[model samples]
Target: MQSEKLYSDLKPLLLSLAYHTLGSVTDAEDIVQEVFLTWEEKPPQQVRDVKSYLCRSVHNRCVDFIRSSSRKREAYVGTWLPEPVNTDKFQKNDPLAEMVWKESLSTAGLLLLQQLSATERIVFLLHEVFRYRFDEIAEIVDKSTANCRQIFHRAKKGIGPLPDRNPEIIEKKAAFAERFAEALTTGNIGLLIELLSSDTVLYTDGGGKVKAALRPIKGSEKIIRYFIGIKDEIPAGTRYETSEINGMPGIRLVVGEMIFAVITFHYLRDQLSDLFVVMNPDKLSHFNRMK
Candidate 1:
């Protein structure tokens, strides 16, 4: 009973760490569940700190999972994108809301995390996103405190600086999303072009399960044309609903009550920058609530 209570309380932090590290919601949940089972097998009294012990277990599992899945990731079709997790359901009292800033949960942010090696990713996330001290992270990663600091610094330099989380900037992003969605649904070509940056790019991930652009569509003009061309291709009953995906404003392309595609945008300054479209059925499976 004590173990169960501890697991329930720590589930949010565990999930946040795993999800941010792996960028896969499904796998994160699986890893956390595995950790819970392991916890159940051991007496809570045997653990020095339940939170630290569980976090270490999750981190180790993520490392193993990443090493094992590298081959599959390399062979993945087209551009591989992280599975988007809707954040609108997060309540004020949710632990995840405190553990991860909205910027850390952004799809763009997760993509940046992918550039990091497994150990670097875990160390960076622990220190940057979860605010763990070097000593705490050293113990979790089973490395010396100095080694962990070096790893964190290396990862930080690789990832550059974190995104701006100013409230005003956040509001601008929200407003931009609303305008962009209106322009898209209304087929306002002029407005769309004006909203997009000159070097705008669109990346689509279909996982070879469905048809999608095999390469990124670059330039504002090309992207505009692509959008125009696809306007007629949308299924008759398809409807779009704006929702918060991975902490950013995103659109869900639903056909007959099924969410088939998700679109997320990244900003360069105040202009609309990169756009990510996920049409892979496998990635969208976790969005069963859409039905």
Candidate 2:
């Protein structure tokens, strides 16, 4: 196949798979470019089953990246969050697109995927999201079909508590996020506590470079207080808006020329369950590019 045609045809699928699996647009784009380079350099006669070949290549690259990333994660300064990707450029313009987009890229779902081992994560993402059969995944991950099945099941069990990445919840979350921003901006502790679930957990990933909680802050009261305590320090020009983040309703903060932070809210039953605040500059470096 012509290199240009080949890349054009597979880039979207590869990007979607890579972004969904790794949750990093920079990494995904890099890996996809590498695949294109390799395809161009290889002899055409060696190529067969283009779809499978591309998928397997990207899959292996993502797994390798994840394995390496896990080590860095251990030494990571504070809470770690999946790198958020802007979906507007790539998501299909259609009615069901929102639902499909969330299923493919919800931050909460991606965070839950971290519970699984690398192998299990690969199996679950391939089998559950991409709809790849066990046999097909076996070739991609180089595991036996039976082993893949076991891993997928284990991944599911580990991720059991996470609610489904349902689009129907978007409406509720949108309201909750607006409420959250209002509370945080105005330092309304009572309303903040009221909006948050009793068991709500707040995770901040400052990557040790910024001042943030080193560990998760649990419960509604503590979380509300945590925000209220910092209200005075939030810089001038800081603005918060409800935006599509990681393919779901989330908050985007901007201060002056820089993109300050991206916060993904996880909610259940109209109550906010978890908040993932990604403040790591390294992680947010690519934020402006995507916007």
Best model number under TM-score: 1
Ten residues in sequence with the least summed lDDT for candidate 2: 94-103
Evaluated at residue 178, the lDDT of candidate 1 is: 81
Error of 2 at 95 (Å): 11
Candidate 2: where are CA atoms >4 Å away? 92-102, 161-168
Candidate 1 runs further than 4 Å off = 43-45, 92-103
lDDT of each: 0.83, 0.77
How well does candidate 1 score on lDDT at residue 241? 80
Each prediction's total of clashing residue pairs, residues at least 3 apart in sequence or on different chains, is 0, 0
lDDT of 1 by residue, 19-118 (tens): 9889888999999999999777864677667788888899889989999999999999999989887776563446555445354557777888888877
lDDT of 2 at 103: 51
- Residue 39 error for model 2, in Å? 1.6
The residue-by-residue lDDT of candidate 2 on 1-291, one tens digit each, is: 677887766677677778777767688889999988987787457655787788888888888888888887799887878887655534545334343344564677887886666567767877776688999888877889998899888888866643454576667777888888888787777888788889999999898888889999999888877887887878887988787777677888888767778888777776888899988877888877655
RMSD (Cα, Å) for all candidates, in order, is 2.1, 2.8
